[model samples]
Target: MSETPLDPRLDEDPYALQKHLGFRLTHWDVDYARLELPIEHFLMNRAGIPHGGIYATLLDTVMGYAGCYTGDPGHKKLALTLSLTTNFLSRPIGHVLIAEGRRVGGGASTFFAESTVSDETGEIIARGSGAFKYRKTRL
Candidate 1:
């Protein structure tokens, strides 16, 4: 469950990559974010399972958002990822993937976040941590 509903502004001007990948922002708060993706055929690898890159993408997006939340809908904080590391924990099972991220620690200019991707059954598919630098301007 999420602490807050996703802001409509997110879908109103979605990121190109997020829109193309078909993941939707599900929740956001001061130091947290969540995203969900319905598994699609195009997202699978030749072996028929969801691709590793898909997991990585979800982890990256969620972790970045965890540190960039701003309460105001008219203004947005941005972060440039400095580094990201993902660990594949287990194969996901089910039709949907859920990713949740939390900001762990940081200063004004840089921050750290950790995230997890889980299947519909709540099995963790991957875990990730990242470092990001806040952008100077708001979006």
Candidate 2:
């Protein structure tokens, strides 16, 4: 039988809350991570596309998680976003969005990662790259 993943909702950090509300980390490895978010009224902007901020948040979360996956399994690496640059490529019109993140460089203390958000049909909606500082979580 497949094992169920632990709930990230129990996390007390605000950043964790934001991530849980948008997308749950579904896949992870040493080099890649995947996440997904549902598109609802709350996620929309006045222009009717998914808000740019939502895309930014999703990208940041995925990239950070990707970095964490590269760390030792028992040591949880929490990442703080240092800088993020996003390029919105297309307007997304879907009920769900997917994000895939991959590590670009660096190691345990600092890292660079990039993520791309796309709609169900595989249209790229946004792409982002960011620098993050990784630290061990306090016991």
Query: TM-scores across all candidates?
Result: 0.93, 0.80
Q: Residue 37 error for model 1, in Å?
A: 0.3
Candidate 2 per-residue lDDT, tens place, 1-139, comes to 1224434542334456665466766666675777778887777789877889888888988898878763444456678899999999997766678888888999657999999999888889999999999865732
Clashing pairs in 1: none
Q: Report the alpha-carbon TM-score of model 1 versus the true structure.
A: 0.93
- Residue 110's lDDT within candidate 2 is 90
**Residue 88: error of model 1 in Å?**
0.5
Misplaced by over 4 Å in model 2 are: 1-16, 70-74, 136-139
> lDDT by residue for model 1 over 37-120, one digit each (tens)?
999999999999899999999999999888988878778789999999999998877889999999999999999999999988
